[model samples]
Target: MSALARTAARLLLGSAMVGAGVLHLTTQRQEFRAQVPEWFPVDEDLTVLSSGVAEIALGAAFVALPGRKRLIGGLLAAFFVVIFPGNVAQYLESTDAFGLDSDRKRLVRLFFQPLLVLWALYGGGWLRRHPTG
Candidate 1:
């Protein structure tokens, strides 16, 4: 991909992370709490707050560190991977957030996780920009 496109993608993702992070800490706190897995043994509010902070940091990194995008992208992808179980828990428990109210909706959402991972990789230019011997 062209540098311009890659930068645009990164900016978009960064903006989303920042927005979601703010939501997690503010208006959507209760909703995010609902997405926490029950068996995790952590306080829901704490989990939401901590994840919100992480999101903000990650988002800022994506926007501020273009030169280190490969590393930032890898970390962001890992973050997505790490939170995937919460998505699964939401589906399995029939917990609704972000309007994923039905089994079909939640199931469909599961597929999007991989897309997020791919997006992070592609936006960071990790997929095709570098050549390995």
Candidate 2:
């Protein structure tokens, strides 16, 4: 994609991360909690809150720190990848969250995780440019 498109995608992704972080700390806390893996040792609420803060910080960086877009984008992409297991747990455990109540719905949701990873990479221009490019 063009540089302009990358910028737009980055901005949109940043906005979305901000929104999701807000939800994590606010109304969607319980919904997010449902995705927490059973084996996770921390309190579900704490995990949600911490991740929310991370999302907000990363999101802000993505939007406000154009000079550091590559670094921020890399971090954001890593973040998406890191949290993927929670999504898998939700699907495997059949835990309903985000309206993904049925098996098919939950299964489909799993595919979106990779898309998020790619989106972050592409939006951040990480996919196009070399790390030192």
Candidate 3:
């Protein structure tokens, strides 16, 4: 992989997660907690705190360790799947229970999560192995 491209993508992806983690960790606690679906059993604080911490770690690691990109990306993809419900909850509720913006924006975020999955797949070398490029 080109170092520059990897670096750029990593930075971009990292910033996103870092920002989100910070939001979830601090300002958006109540909002995020409220957004948790009724089906989930975890406590709001632990869920929010753990999720935020994971995002920051995965995001930062993706940038800091290119050689381990595949591992980090895979982990992040799993995280994306784990958080899919939150996105769905946001869409279903049309509320900013933990966000700073509108429902429309939250819907947009739902779409973006898939791209992150794909990015993670690519970053992790799954794409390279398949050889479509």
Candidate 4:
């Protein structure tokens, strides 16, 4: 990707993360809580709130700290990986949230996780050996 394209992608992803983080902390708190795995040890509300904060911080950093894009992108990728199980649990246990009210919907959503990881990596210039973008 060209420098402009990579920057655009990074900004778009950053903006999306911020928006989702805001939703997690506000109107969608319950929805996010619902996605937490029942077997996980953390309290649902705490998990939701903490993750929301994390998303916000990571998102903002990704946008505002281009110098740290590699680190932040890796962190963002890890965050997505960490949350994959919740998405899996939502599918396996048939938990409904975020309009993923069916097994098919939930299952399909799972596929997007890897794409997110790749997107972060690309935006961070990890996909390039010596990124000009």
Candidate that scores best on lDDT: 1
TM-scores, one per candidate? 0.94, 0.95, 0.78, 0.95
The CA lDDT at 109 in model 3 is: 82
Better of 3 and 4 by TM-score: 4
What's the C-alpha lDDT at position 36 in model 4?
96
| Pairs in steric clash, model 2 | none
Give the CA lDDT, 0 to 100, for residue 51 in model 4.
94
Q: Candidate 2, TM-score vs. the true structure? A: 0.95
What is the C-alpha lDDT profile of model 2 across 1-133, one tens digit per residue? 6899999999999999999999999999999998899999999999999999999999989999988888989999999999999988888899988899998999998899999988888888888955473
What lDDT does each candidate get?
0.93, 0.92, 0.79, 0.92
* Worst lDDT 10-window in candidate 4: 124-133
Please, what are the lDDT tens digits per residue for candidate 3 over residues 1-133? 6656655776788778889889888887777787777667898789889988998888888878888888888898899898898778777866565452686887888888798888777666655534386
The number of the candidate with the highest TM-score is 4
TM-score of 3: 0.78
Mind giving the per-residue lDDT tens digits that candidate 4 earns over 4-71? Answer: 88788788898899999999999999999999999999999999999999999999999999999999
| Clash pairs for candidate 1 | none
